[model samples]
Target: MPKFFNTAGPCQSDIHYTLPTGDRLPQLEKLIAQRNYFVIHAPRQTGKTTAMLTLAQELTASGAYTAVLLSLEVGAVFPHDPGAAERAILDEWKQSIKFRLPENLYPPEWPDTNAGSMIGTLLSNWAKKASRPLVVFLDEIEALSDETLISVLRQLRSGYPNRPQGFPHSLALIGMRDVRDYKIAGGGSQRLNSSSPFNIKVESLTLQNFSLADVKNLYKQHTEATGQIFTPEAIERAFYLTDGQPWLVNAIARQATEVLAPDVATPITVDLINQAKEILIQRQDTHLDSLAERLREDRVKAVMQPILAGQDLPNVPNDDIQYLVDLGLCKIDNGQGLEIANPIYQEVLPRVLSYTTNASMGRIESRWLSDKGELMPMELLEAFLGFWKQHGEPLFKSTPYPEIAPHIVLMAFLHRVVNGGGTIEREYAIGSGRMDICLHYGKVILAMELKVWREGKRDPLDEGLQQLDKYLSGLNLDTGWLVIFDRRPDLLPLSDRTTTEIATSPAGRSIIVIRG
Candidate 1:
């Protein structure tokens, strides 16, 4: 069968388009060779499984060690029952070893042990039987929760002294989080002792996304196989949109080649990659949906809510911020500070946040469109003004984040434009209390900035004008919209207070100023 991009599961070399998984993490061999226990983590679908599986095969092939990949995910089903979880994990490992290692390399039968010491004892007996030193990679270690997670960690740590004889010579716990961030069932990490569980001597590492060179090499494989090409611009654009996210890189290419264009003769272009992005967002594939699900958690909200509002983040725990970074939702740039991880994530965040308001919106007519189906900028503006008069207050009451309520309402309104075949790109000026939207239609590109007039703060008109002027210049447009929504405690009713008028920006460009 012809090789294709694999997204549903770990990439297999013979059947999937894959890169050298080891190249992404060159320290694995050295770390294992040193008989160190370490942790491997990254956001979900980041090729952690694939990398570990590949590494296991390579090490076992070297004949110096017996290595195998095992998973604890099935154990998660019995969060509070360490015994049952351990049994299930071991049963799964039997199959993994059968699949991963040669028959002669398979260890003697698992050591039958009581509930609490099953994992350690099993590894001990297996290592003693193996012809070579044993190396094990435990994937989805975080899935073993509550008593199970803590129990497994302690067992592994307790068995550390028996390495090369009684226990595996090298072991790695793999999951989406670092050792410190493992989730306990029903609550926080308070259930864990600071150092009792996984304080083994070694390093904690993350598998990074593909680099630009990796992306280029990956796409080159598809080109070589199919005789179709990804233009230089398309590869760069894909890298930019995805930040070399493994799932996203394959997803975009898969969507383009398999669904969007599909013809091997037709080259994959930048436009197709852009279209694939829209489809993936619409599809909300399992990976993206999993990320969206994280948005509802309070831990995620503590940092994200402020980031979404363009306000300075409140005093949140450092781990809370790192939680997001670990999840790949946000990253800290040295100069730019904390921001969304990549362009695709930045685009998805606001839309997912405002999903409820977008769904609650009543029917929208085509009144804003010209006869040619082109979006009439003024008509669309009028539609928003009318909608705000009727639904803006309710939207505010319904918004999930009060600090970003107006911004969400505006996005909800603009989503209608997107449904009418237009697109809106947004940028948030963090700590500036502002968001800018650039709407693209057939030949009309409209720019707008949203700012709030909070209590104790003067009207933001002058600052907004100066900002919008720069924004408009960036769009190479001579005009744009600056909206100031009054959010003070004593503000008047929405219908009565909303108003719009024409003005000039600081750069002498025509500006539509809307103060509500």
Candidate 2:
């Protein structure tokens, strides 16, 4: 059977096109030899499980260590009951060992124990009986929180010193987050600082998304297997859209191969890759949907809200930033500052925020589209003016985040204009203090910049004109619009405030300045 790109669970060599897992973690053997307890963390679906599983299998087959990979997810169900959670985890471990290990390597039976000490006791017994030194990888360690998490970490900490005889020679806690950010929720509400409990860990390593080379190699496997060539542009586009996010990389190729162009002889192109990307975002598949769901989290909002609004950075803590980075929502861009992790996320975030508003915008007539389906910027502007005078306040109130309310409402209105035949691309980041949008329909391209007039700040018209000038230069468009939303408390009603006029940019380009 021909292999396909895999999005769910671990990738199987016989069924999926996968990069070499062992190569991604070259430090595993050294870590095992040194008897280190460590943390392996990454955003979801980044091949952590596949890497650990393969490493465990390779270690066992090498006849040097009896390595096992088991999950702690079951324990999450009994968060408040440490004993019950421990019991569930031990049972899971026993079953996993029974299936994966040879008869001679099976663990000795776990002693019946209360929840608090169950895991420590089980590991101690297993290590005592194992023919060789034992190595264990505990996947989904983040799922077990509160008392269960505390109990499990403490037990592992307690058993750290007695290795190769009383406890496993090496241990790994694998999950979506690094250990530093763990806070025992519910009754135990303190942060799990690295100084105690599982301080035995030597390092907190993270799995990186596929590099550009990794992506090309992965797609090259498909070409080798089935002779369906992925164009160099297609491969590059896949990397740019996904930033090497594992699920997205595979999902794009899978969509292109299996749905968009099933004929193996036809080479996949960048256009088809873009089509696949649009489908993935529109479908809101489980991976992207779950990531969108994280937008509702307070930590996520603290970082994301400002980026969406193009406002200055908020006073968010370092841990919050690290948490979002671990989740793959945003990353620190060199020395500049925090930004959405990639271009695709930059597109998806605002769209997700405006989804409901876009749906509700059906009452607004699509007046901007010409009879020939061309987009008229001035017509769109007039429609927005009318809509803002009538329904903008209510829509603004309905927005989830106050910081980005103006941006979201405008996006929702624009989405109506671009829904069927046009495309709107957005670029906003913290410290930019402006959101830039480019609307494309047929050959007509419109560039727009959105800013806000706060109570004490000067009207942003001059700065906006200069910014729009550079933006238009980049897009090679000689004309654009600059919109400054008046958000001051003393401002007049929307009906009186909404107006547009012409201005010239520093680069001498024509710019339409709108104040509302």
Candidate 3:
């Protein structure tokens, strides 16, 4: 059978297009040789499990180490019962060893001990009995609750001094975050600790998303296996859309090859890649849905709300922002400012929050469309003005992120207009002070920039117009709209305050200044 893209779990080279797992982490052998107990973490689905598993196989095959990959996830189920969690975890570990290792390499039965300290004892016994030095990768270490996690980490730290002879020579704690960012809660406390119990880590290593070359090499595997070709533009577009996210990279190609364009001879194109993205978002695949779930987190909120409103970032802790970066929700930009990690996430974040509002909206007639079914820019603007005058206030209260409520309402309204037939691309970042949108409709492109006029702040009309001019230049458009929302107190009702005016940008671009 021809190999295809794998998105759900660790990639199997036999049936998946995979990069050499060792290429991504060249220091693993050196780290192991040094008897280091380190960490390897990245956002979910970025090939952590795949790399570790491959590394384990390679080390065991070389007869230099008795390597195994084990999971701590079972322990999460017994969060309050550390003893029970450890028993379950060790049982799972034994089963895993039975399946993965030869009889000579199998661990002796775990020593009988109190459940709380079983993991440490188990590893100690295994290393002592093994023919070669033992190396273990502990996966899903973050799933354990605070007390359980603390227990496990303390055990590992306690066992750290007994290397080579009594404990695993090298160990890796694998999860979605570095050791420092683990969310340790419960036990009647709601505060995060900066210094965790597992501070003995020699180093923390992160697996990066696939590079452009890595993505191309992966796609080439499919082309070599089958006659199907992915256009160079398609690969580049895929990389751009996903920012090299491994799951997304595979998902896009998988959808395009297996669903969007199944014929072996039909080459994948940029348009097909985009369609795959839309389909993935619409379907809310497990990977994307997992990320959407993080939006409600307080740490995630502190960083994300500013980006949504295009306001200056709040005084959030650096570690909080770094946590989001580790989770792949955001990334450090060229200038070290944080932004949404990729275009797909940029779209998913707003739409997921506005989902209920988008659904609750009452029936709206297609007043913005011309007789020929094309979107009329002026008509669309008028329709939005009418909607805002009628429903914007109530809709604002319906959203959780009030700072970006207006932006969400506007996006919700535009969502109704586009409805999958068109596309809306948003550009906003911390410190941008405005959100810019580019609407793509049938044979027409409309640009818009939204700013809020606060009571104590100066009206941003002039600044908005200047910014819109620069935005229009990029779109190669001669006209666009600058929407300034008047959020000042003592303002009249929406009907009275909402209005529009035609103005010109400094670069002579036609600007529709909508004051609402």
Candidate 4:
């Protein structure tokens, strides 16, 4: 039986495996033949190392080239000292080859050299001895110092002409960021020439999570191995919670098969996936830790804040957006907007950001009175506005996440309304304008979009109308509310602001407009 769940690096012959599902494999295979220097990057735990190792084996087995997967991550542990970095890498190279290759083929001893020049020397020596074209897969390349990176790139450039004979024919640098975007501190700003050291990269590839079909294939692997069947509904539920992220996909299936439904006769259902998701989130594993770490950066916040506020983001540079996308924190939505990359991220980001504020917000979770047990949308808005009027100035002065205060207040209000009866689903990112809050009561859904009104703006009515229209359309709801917060005190006459119910949006969908 094949070992199906692999969390470490790529799966070996004895371990379980899932066939590559995304766009990366074909691209890597093409690069292997073309002898390109390129990058493979994605969120942590997305199986990058595993995929590269697997690809290397495939290339070697074909007898067309000699492939080796080398890790530079150990160099990172030594800081920027090139000498130490070189020694560590040489040590790792020896160990990796010893473990992966036949004993007779392993190098007996590595040549001594300064760290800055060791990599180039090592590669040149290895290439001289090998008969076939050498393909080097350098994993965790980002962990090396900027100077080391520049040196490495230059060495590759200096040795390219010797490829297919005297040097590695194909080189792949794998890490969290693309090779071009990597800003190696202290390294001279020499633009990398595609034609030189590692030119002719067929493409830069990112490993994506499993698709719904991929998710089913994963579960099918377990069933084939253990004879445990997962109900179709359970599969759908797993997709809904994990959005087909590779780690989460494997995790959910593993939990269900091993813990939730170990017996083949027992049916794995939707509830089991949901239960597994909750368990995973609460555990806050390394996957979650890596994602949360990105949130602390100003760049990430700048992009995510507007999404939480439900406002349109001003045009940001393509490079900035692409950087975040590469980090797996956000994605371009249908080429129209940006959205959190996955359900788990969508669920956890806000909670992680609101951990401190949610406590105070929780205080008002059930403060309002609604006899029908429904959130009185207009009433809740008015109550929040009234509080904002009296305490807004001071609260803004003290709030840590002030950029998202209005949204937080709204969440606090909703938390009060749905305290005992319903749940709120929030979607917001720093730069993605517009926050989506879905309040659910059993089967009924109440959706609201929150926006911030800038000074001198014409009430933001046109923009608000357009956003509400899109929100309602997406939810397939005929009517919903647009709550606009006027940040400027000059426009504030608290009592005169009105809440009007409109029949049709200027764009033509019926929406309720509530201004405060």
Candidate 5:
């Protein structure tokens, strides 16, 4: 029984290759020892459950406290009914404690209580009768919304004053978001204007993703156990693509080792990691698919729309931006600006947003492809112009985000071209004012830049040519295209405004300038 990379659930030490729990989070012994209640949050599958579960077991084993991690997720079905939710949640707690603790440490029988207060009552009685101090880690704390969420928070806060004598010595609320972001009611309303009921928490801490060093160490364990080698380049590439997100780190390794190169004698290389990444993105694994689902969320879209289009974030609420960060959709890069969390997410987000339009383009004629399957830049340009004249406006209505409909529709068209045998890599960021695409097919590569001319903005041809010149130099390509999507309200119809011309970049590269 050799250990393997785990992506499905909490890692089990004997069965999964994992970093030390102590390395993943700050020392909490002092807080628990002092009877402090705190919040622990992180994105889904980043090992919050594993860390807290292992910590609870280790603390109970130390003989100084009775500890266990339980979940409120099972109670989510009763979101509006606090009494039922509490009863269901308490039952799970009793079962967990019985399984995790010795008979001497088991909680006493529950008290008969009316309606919604059973959660607090049960905790108080359990703490009072325990041989040692009791510590509880409440997992999935965000599942309850509205009245149920408020009720649970207030109950936990009320029990804070009676610690070690009438209530648990320490309690931790664990979830994917900080308590303030929790929705307090229906209709997409958040807790923006209200004071939290669980205001007793001393600190709101987050479980961070693994670091590069942690990733290297975790992968090295697999080599040790199975004699399979992950090349240094592959390890760094995985970290770059996933940004050390726990599930993604494990998933990429699992896909490479288990599916792509199962033989221990076959060493994993950078190319294998890239192939594994494509497989993961195409398969839409549970982890990636769940994240893609958030692209349609209003809060998520508000922040993501601009980043995807290389525009500035304006008028978007700070809480909404933080919500995206908390969910691991985006990050404030180096305090410089907001960007997608990682490279893989950068790829996945646009592809998911353009899925419908991309799919609608069926059996695309390979006019831009040579007999050897190589791409031709001029052929691609002609094809795009013809497509824009015929179908661009109709497909614009098919895009997911209105702010970047032109970009999305364009990507959808390119996806059709790349879907056959090529790859399209995208690079865009907040305030860049343009999106860049590098299309690869066979031995041929095409570079392009996209800019939008909105109302009150000047023509972007000059700026676009200058930017494309810099971009072409980086790719060492002698020619590229600059597409300025004129989305001004006063513009003529799509058929009448679409046209193209040739120009020279500042660096003397041939630049194809398209205005549509």
Candidate 6:
């Protein structure tokens, strides 16, 4: 039987393998021939290692070069000791070569010593003895310590001039980040410039998730080997939930094939895919755990707050956004703003961050807004404001993420309101105008746009009006409400403040502005 699961690493020949559907391969192949140092980066499990391995195999099979795959992850464990790390790396190199190439074809002169200098010496000797141009692929390059990483980069730079005559012809560094972002601290406050060390890098390529067609093609592999097949709806559901994430696609398929249907009479359907997704999430598998791990970082929170609040994130550095994208936590939309990459990420984030607090909110069914199937817009806003008045101060104090306290409370309250009856879809991005929250009940749609109250200014009102109008227009609705949290201690409510319906933008819909 063909292997179906590939969670630990790339799929092998006997395993069910899906060809890379990304467009980077042709450019990669071209770069390899030119003997250039390049970088391959992507979020974990997006298949960077698999792509590199496959490319290495293809390059070796073409009779143009002796390609090898090596990993530097082991070096990350001993960040302070470059010597031992280099030894571990050399040992892994030997194992990789033995696994891929025949014993006779393996270079016989490879140095057996674990010394730091031996790394460059061994590669140099092997390249000189090789019959063709040599290519070296270093996977998990980001895991190496600053000293070791710099050592590796400098060795490659030192050997670059020799090229096919004395050293490896080309080299590739594969990792979770681009070379420029590497921060290596050494003896007594000395810092290494990662990009400068590897200045010879010709191109940086990022591997993307599988496409819809690729998901179909992958599923077909299982069907071709076994007699079972995925129904069209099942395939569509898989794409919807996974957004073509390689691991998720394979995992959901494997669940459906092996676990969901033990008999051939049952057809794989959308329901089965949904069941598999829930199981996967509940299992807290490595994929979900890995994605959630970044949420604990302050930088990740800095980028996510605005998206959650439906407000523009000002002064956020470009590097921060790039970091989140590399982690696969967010993606750029229309080159304008960043949004969570997929539903699974969206669902996992809020739950992982607020599980304890949400649970303490006391069963939503017994809470303040449980009487009606869906709370009326103004009523829900008023209740949340009241709850904030009583508990908001404490909640904000307890929150680790103060910038997003209001956002978390609002989401929690809404989640409480719709706990069992409906769903709320949220959309926000760093540097976007505002966060958009759409509460969906069978047919009744309540769209809310949230904005932080700017002290001593009416700009929040104008911003709120503009955002509510946009939300209404996007949902094809005629009217919507904007709720603003006034943080000013001195400002008293306008008891006579009536809800006003006014045209916001010429092309946008009119909005109901509620000032609290």
Per-prediction TM-score to the true structure, in the order listed: 0.97, 0.96, 0.97, 0.80, 0.97, 0.81
Worst 10-residue lDDT window for candidate 6 reads 493-502
- CA error at residue 502 for candidate 3, angstroms: 0.8
- Looking at candidate 4, what is the lDDT of residue 20? 62
Tens digits of per-residue lDDT for model 6, 435-491: 677887656788877776766656577666766666677898876767665565566
C-alpha lDDT of residue 81 in model 3? 83
Candidates 3 and 5 compared: the better one by lDDT is 3
Candidate 5 lDDT by residue in tens digits, 262-314: 99999999999998888877777888889999998887888899898899888
Greater TM-score among 4 and 6 belongs to 6
Q: Look at candidate 5 and tell me the lDDT of residue 12.
A: 92
Q: What is the lDDT, from 0 to 100, of the residue 218 in candidate 5?
A: 97
| lDDT per residue (tens digit) for residues 1-516 in model 2 | 889999888988789888886668888789989999999999999999998988898899999999999999999989889988887888787788888889898877877977598889989999998999999999998887788888889999999989979999999999998886676878435567553778888988999888999999999999999999999989999999999989999999999999999999989999999888878867878888888998988778888898888888778888888988999998887976888988777878888888877776667778887898788877888888899888877788777788778788899888777766777888888889999999888798988999998989998999999888889989989999898988889777888888889888888887888888
Better of 2 and 5 by lDDT: 5
lDDT of 1 by residue, 173-221 (tens): 9988888778775754443424448899598899888999999999999
| Superposition-based RMSD of candidate 1 using all C-alpha atoms, in angstroms | 1.4
The residue ranges of model 6 lying beyond 4 angstroms of the native Cα positions read 3-5, 20-24, 110-114, 186-194, 226-241, 255-284, 359-390, 413-423, 430-433, 438-448, 459-483, 489-516
Clashing pairs in 1: none
Q: What lDDT is reached at residue 510 by model 6?
A: 61
Worst 10 residues of 4 by lDDT: 188-197
Candidate 4: clashing residue pairs, number? 20
RMSD of 5: 1.5
Question: For model 2, what is the alpha-carbon lDDT of residue 70?
Answer: 91
- TM-score quality measure for candidate 2: 0.96
Give the runs in model 1 whose Cα sits over 4 Å from its true position.
185-195
- Superposed model 2: Cα runs more than 4 Å off: 187-190
**Lowest summed lDDT window (length 10), candidate 1:** 187-196
RMSD in Å for model 2: 1.6
Instruction: lDDT winner between 2 and 4, please give it.
Output: 2
